[model samples]
Target chain A: MTTQAEHRMPTAALPADASGLLPAAEPIRFLDDDGGPAPGDAHGRYQRPATELLRQAYRAMVVGRRFDSQATALTKQGRLAVYPSSRGQEAGEIGAVLALRDTDWLFPTYRDTMALVSRGIDPVEALTLLRGSWHCGYDPTTTRTAPQCTPLATHAPHAVGLAYAARRRGEDTVALALVGDGGTSEGDFHEALNFAAVFHVPVVFLVQNNGYAISVPLSRQTAAPSLAHKGVGYGVRGERVDGNDPVAVLAVLGDAVESARAGGGPVLVEAHTYRVEPHTNADDDTRYRDHDEVEMWKRRDPIARLEAHLRTAGELTDDDVSAAREAAEAFADDVRTRLGEEATGDPADLFAHVYAEPTAQLREQARWLAEELAHEHGAGEAR
Target chain B: MTLTMGKALNAALRDALREDDSVVVFGEDVGPLGGVFRVTDGLTAEFGEERCFDTPLAESGIVGLALGMAMNGFRPVVEMQFDAFAYPAFEQLASHVAKMRNRTRGAVGLPMVIRVPYAGGIGGVEHHSDSSEAYYAHTPGLKVVTPATVADAYSLLREAIADPDPVVFMEAKKLYWSKDETGLPVRTAPFGTAEVRRAGSDATLLAYGPTLPVALQAAEAAAGDGRQLEVIDLRTLVPFDDETVAASVRRTGRCVVVAEASGFASVSAEIAARVQERCFHSLWAPVLRVTGWDIPYPPPVLEKYHLPGVDRVLDTVDRLQWDDAPDSRFLSGAAT
Candidate 1:
């Protein structure tokens, strides 16, 4: 994007670069059609993530794909409420998440199962939210990962506040908030960007511009040159990276996270990517998108790009690919076993977490529920 | 020290900051200007800028940042500046702060206090005076409270800050200047408890926040006319002290609730419903509510007419029949 647009700054200049907000022209990319290194200063500075990181990214993408398929199959099997698969955009999710330290937080949207899986959350636990179960599948405090936020961009400010509060306590915890392009239109997104910049909070925002938010496409989402450009108005450093290129996403996100940890202001990175599947099982892509467009994006698939690069470099053999597939299948089988059990929901689950200290009214309500459940079960113990 | 509501609130905030380093206080002009009403006056001077400070004029950002801070272990006490000015942050309050802990299933709790200066009769402009306790009370995960006494103001606010859940603490704007002797007794009722401010034999008056003093005055006027009226201060609105109000109603057999929020779907309505449910047999008269008219808060000059005053409370009490129980449906607005 060109150096354009005026800031809505009302106070002292925010924590931003002093110069004008001129973001890079195209998404910063490092890999080509044949997986050769591209040319650019950012590209030259080793946008090539370490070989180990790439290998892990490859594994994560494969497992993420398998997990996505399993979730979709479970929904078909009458298991989950819904599943927003991160199919074509696995690299964007995994690349940025792997850059975060264990102490750091990864705030995921409903569509970001890949982030949770890559962050070491159990495959079964990761799908629990989709399974219509209680709680956010995993312990957020233990894993430093927030629950799946269904509301668009709401978690952005939370991530900023967490990082800001962490710094106040003399902790060096970075927060990476992930969102879709459509989420950037939300008021919470604007507030989060402004507050994060104003407070110099240690947070990195990653907008996986997955081409469409359900049926709403990117063009209808914003009038700005690009989603990343919207960040500069809040006085945050805005950059665009190739979502399909795992190396570039890792390099850019890694740099942003490191810079934030060292007290650099919060940054916004938009990864240009696509959601190859329907928004969920509930949406129809054919209504708004052309088949040719889907075909076009298939050629640019993140996993295929990475796998080709790995194979061409002789870093990944055919047997290794087969082994990766076998591991992914094993994970899917484990998730299937966990989800196959009959749901024996507890009657008290509704009132359990409403407060750390349940009020008199809530306690009374819980009592009523217990008694009613007991009566229904012929005076059996309240489940 | 004889403390007004504002000074009592200041003392509470001061005590909280002194007690916990994790507690932070911030809002517009809270740092140097001591807040628009001086509730946070000198707090920044006593505590450093880190513990107490100012923020931008954006209310949404203020509350959002505070929620974020709370999620990360900081007990943030944010001022809404004015009652209606807090509307901008309603989305954040309802969607995030109020539901974070429950939605996260006990993994994260929003232990913060959102202080709003609410109520009419303060002769302030449009958005300056509003009674929004009902909105917070309606939200599931929040504890809505308003203290009508100086002791409760000091003690309730300190407890709210220390509570392990979010509390929407409404500071009655009109009561900010109402004073009481502070050194007599520092003891105050804990949150979710109701104390009978006055005692009598005929009827019970249920009121909270800005309407408590009005109910007290109405009780005094009723006494001159040989009609005994007891006053109950419902300091907490959410986990409402139903037992106190219900028991009083059972004994007196008559009731009238007063408030500055509109007559429709209000916190007053909530208390009235609960009292009706718990004391249906003992009730001699259907509960009556004396509240602001079902209209947007009018201009400052006409606020007196809109707010329930002593006369309105008395008029509602007079409408309560000692002979027969009236239809409960008509109890919400018959007197007005």
Candidate 2:
């Protein structure tokens, strides 16, 4: 429960280079790339939670990376129809999701399986969607996490709507909606931002500026210098953070979440990161981006950076690191086994949850399908 | 009652607002000005600005906010101003408002009604005069209702407001000023029931919204020609009044469905399918649909050619007439 006064600054007095984007050689860093503390850096702003909290964030990211990698492999193996890997943008997902309370809602795009993991959604459930067996993997109300939306930026308005609802109900909940840099090109993004700002809705627009939108560079996405600056036009407070630094992301997101929960309205956070992997299983990034550029982003690996910081801080050891990796592998294996072993969903399941009270037409269709399936597979085969 | 369909709707909304403090009406220009159509005239004065309010110009925001209010335990009835204006709110309607209950496993019920003034007859341009009910009916979670008569305009609105799920209440803009005899009790019409405007044995003319009157007129003209056509007005599109439709089609053995929506995948298509499936043996002719052309709704002057009219209905009836061809399957009681 941080007060607005503690976080507020006079609009005119704030430093123009607070974000450390350009003209300033001094980059914003608390823990350097080698994981050692940068003396006199904004360490106060980087408020560390319990050791377990940091460990949980690291563990989630590791597992998310594994799930992302394996799912891509599955797609290549034809077990999955498609997979959108959040390979390079793990910190953006993990940091923001880690800051969210269970009561808060998450509106994620298709590539945000990492955020879904942090929200307590089982990886298998997300895989079920990529496998094309289910439309939505989990009920949103039960988990406070909406199903991944494929239509770019459409879910933005929904998140705003939900946050408006929460605000009206006087709930201390916030909605964090994840979108790619490319989604900023959509009118829905602007509409959602404008609506959220005007309504004073408690929503966080987390834009993972991964530099490319399915091969389209960020330069082509918008004419604006930075996505965060777009928020100023809508009268929302905006911040840009290094997406590779999980600590900085966590700090900035925690501040945004607190501000939103305290009735300060919505904020736009642009996590400047790069996508290390191709857009999806179907894409080949070699055509659009050079190997040198990929290598440069790879050096700023969110996981490697965070691991280095933790090791230098004496919060993690080699055995602990080995155990975390082992655990992530085990989790991925478990998910793979569950997905591979699980039976294909019954077609009747489609009609089952359409409505709590099934319509007469739906019932008829379900019955017809059941009878048809039974006929095809012999008696009593359809459920 | 000498009231326009719009007046009836406003009266119905006013009554609902008077009856419950939880009932709130919101849309663009719904307050102060009482809407562009003046359907909601004098409501702001009657209920005050809090209960009857104007929302921002954003259609999706209006619907989305109404959904939030509904989830927060308020009954919100939103107006789309016109049929075409609802497209901006389609995502909210399709993704959230309609599916909220099912998505949340019934933990929440979106008790909101979106009033869309649809259909053609008025000299509205293309976007304003579109019949978009088929789009809504195609969506699974929404209950779509279109009122043809003034009494229906009053009663069906009350029913839509009280329904647990989100309901799309489409009013034929052309019928907004059209009045009907009043004195019917304002009660909840069951969701899946069709009202028989006129019952006959020769052929069943199925219609709804503005086309209902055309069907009734067509039935009357056919009656003079020795063909007693049954006229059935389908009130609800989703959870369709299959019983009423099937009963009429079973007796008449011939059916012609009319709607202002495009001919392809119109509500008439659904009626045609139900009739073919349920009364397959009773059918003597293929269920013909008299609907708007597949092209975009024509300009007002050319709308007569696009929209189904009494002449079109009569032409369809003549095409199916047994007297025109004594060996016609329509009279021979043979399935085509």
Candidate 3:
């Protein structure tokens, strides 16, 4: 009963942005890779991020990289089960967090420890899932952040639902979901976009196009013009930015988040970046990638680019850089000392928290486990 | 007031939505159309769009939306529309909804319900009929409940929505039109307890959801043969009522599990094993099972042969050891 034209009819109005469906001709850049100011005409699509925010982002990137390395070392020491380092992509990671207010919600992926750290969450709690102590360490409601989701793109719809609920409650809350390039290929990604667009909820889908999903290249992920272009079909405004450029990432993401907050509907921003490290500690970069490719991305490091620009503009002094590095080393040292100690958890905790009120079966099983532990240790105590 | 099980379920949802401002219902065709089965009929008219609405026909998105809304302080009751169609949302249900509370160390509890119209016997074609309760029951951290009677349908649904955990509430499609004289807001025994629909002394007939009616009918037919069959309706599949079922099986010394699903590694199979394990010395014979054949759901014309009927249940009940067994049966290892 439906015709092709009727099926093709646009579901909602075009996004309120002037650029409409297509993104900027080039990835929006406010700073060149060498840390010099980009050509003014090249970044006319968005304004440069503020100096204060840029300085903050730069220091956070420094601390974030140190945290990343510390967690990687903990993995080798068996303190953590595994760690996914966001080393080269710190700009997009920190920029996404810096763009949002504490009242807003953030949905992070397993590779987004830097974003959580930038959100002011304790570094220890942020690494809990990777530490193997619990599935999620921090309370999501208290932190206004969801657990770091491991399944790719599955949290996209959750962001949409939460954002929609906030709107229905008459609150000006926006949800920003951090996703990888490979996540764009998932069905949840498209479904979440469509739902957000249809409801016109406040949400920002930030896709950090970090070149690869594990060893699979982006070429195999999609053949579209760009990950951002895929948003056009869902009537969401699409924007692309140089993820390595801190100024561009913050500027574009800030615009997208604020625009969604003002009810301009959801916006999908694609950050063109690269992952310098392997997927995780267990993965071998040499198997599917070249050392030369890793070396090339290392040259375009996000931290070095932003630090150079800030120093030239006199926004960061020599003393400020030293203070930043010193703070980072102290933070890493604290983390190392704390991680060296073994984690202690009660065995009974396994039966706890499965339900709000434990079922009879759970109670019986818990009792059985308690008795087993008692007999095994010859202790008279029963939990 | 006389009520059909379907209408009772509708009344329960209406009452729950009225009592809780945080409660919202949404799914494909749930709004405006009032659901294809009409169980959700007239909800949108009473609650307005924010409370009851339609969604894109993606099952995963529907359930995923419930997870998010629940996280943000909303009790979302989502409909899977059918039994087999819910497979698309299994990842969301199993990975997030079922595990969110435990995953967060009890920081998050999803007070949501996934309504699935399940089981065979209305002569419906494939995909429309499936007994998928075992999948949810096997997954930890989810409460799986199904209602057979009109009163139980209203009571259990209200309980499921109020519980601070995710529940997979399966509605037996075949029993939807069956009627009783129960009024709105009727209360029944809470979940995790089985109800004895018929009490007897010879053997126990254990069933749930769609198979409860078949078991009761078989009991009535067995009465004509001087067999007193005790029928137990296991309303809640998970957190199963081990005490009630074991007590009845111990008294009767025999149990036959009746279900519309295939018997292999199923909810019925689980009940049979548990009853035997708990009451091994008291059991007069090995537990028997009457269930659908192990195959994909068949066309409407062939479903009658594949589904368990009263005759099949009675035949399985006949296999239970009795004092009247022939002498030759002892030589065949068929006697206790």
Best by DockQ: 3
**DockQ of all candidate complexes:** 0.52, 0.29, 0.55
The residue pairs found clashing in candidate 2 are: none
Task: Give lDDT tens digits, candidate 1, residues B1-336.
Answer: 877888889988998888788899988889878998999999988886778888767788888889888888789999999989999888889988888788777888989999999987878887788888888889999998899999999889988998999999999988999999886335588888999999998999998998898999999999999999999999998768888988899999999988889989988788789889899998877888998988989998887789888888888888788646565547688768
* Model 3: residue A218 alpha-carbon error in angstroms: 0.3
What does candidate 3's lDDT look like per residue over A1-383, in tens digits?
11112111113355576558678778998788788888767676688788999888888888888989999999999999999988899989999999999999999999999889778888888888988888898999989999999989999999998988887777888999999999999989988998888878789999999999998999999999999998888888899999999988999999999999987889999999999989999999888889998888888888888889988988999888998899889889988988788876777778899999888889989999999987977755543
- A72-117 per-residue lDDT for model 2 (tens digits): 8777667787888899888888988888999988888889887787
Instruction: State how far residue A56 of model 3 sits from its true place (Å).
Output: 0.8
True contacts kept of each: 0.66, 0.24, 0.79
In candidate 2 chain A, what residue range of length 10 has the lowest lDDT sum? Answer: A1-10
Per-residue lDDT over B1-336 for candidate 3, one digit per residue giving the tens place of the 0 to 100 score = 989999999999999999998998989998879998888899999987777888888999999989999998899999999999999999899899989999899998999999999988888777999889989999999999999999999999999999899999999998899999987798899989899999999999999999899999999999999999999999999769999999999999999999899889998899889988999999888888898988988899999998889998887777786764643434676755
- Candidate 3 DockQ, CA atoms: 0.55
How good is the docking of model 3, by CAPRI class? medium
Candidate 3's displacement at residue A180, Å, is 0.7
Score every model by TM-score: 0.95, 0.87, 0.96
Q: How does candidate 1 score on lDDT?
A: 0.85
Candidate 3 chain A: worst-modelled 10 consecutive residues by lDDT: A1-10
Per-residue lDDT of model 1, residues A108-217, tens digit only: 99999877987899876787788777657788889899888887888887898788888877788999999999999998899888888877788999999999988999
Task: Give the winner by lDDT: 1 or 2.
Answer: 1
> Candidate 2, residues B175-234: lDDT per residue as tens digits?
988876676455636778789889899899999998999999998888888999999889
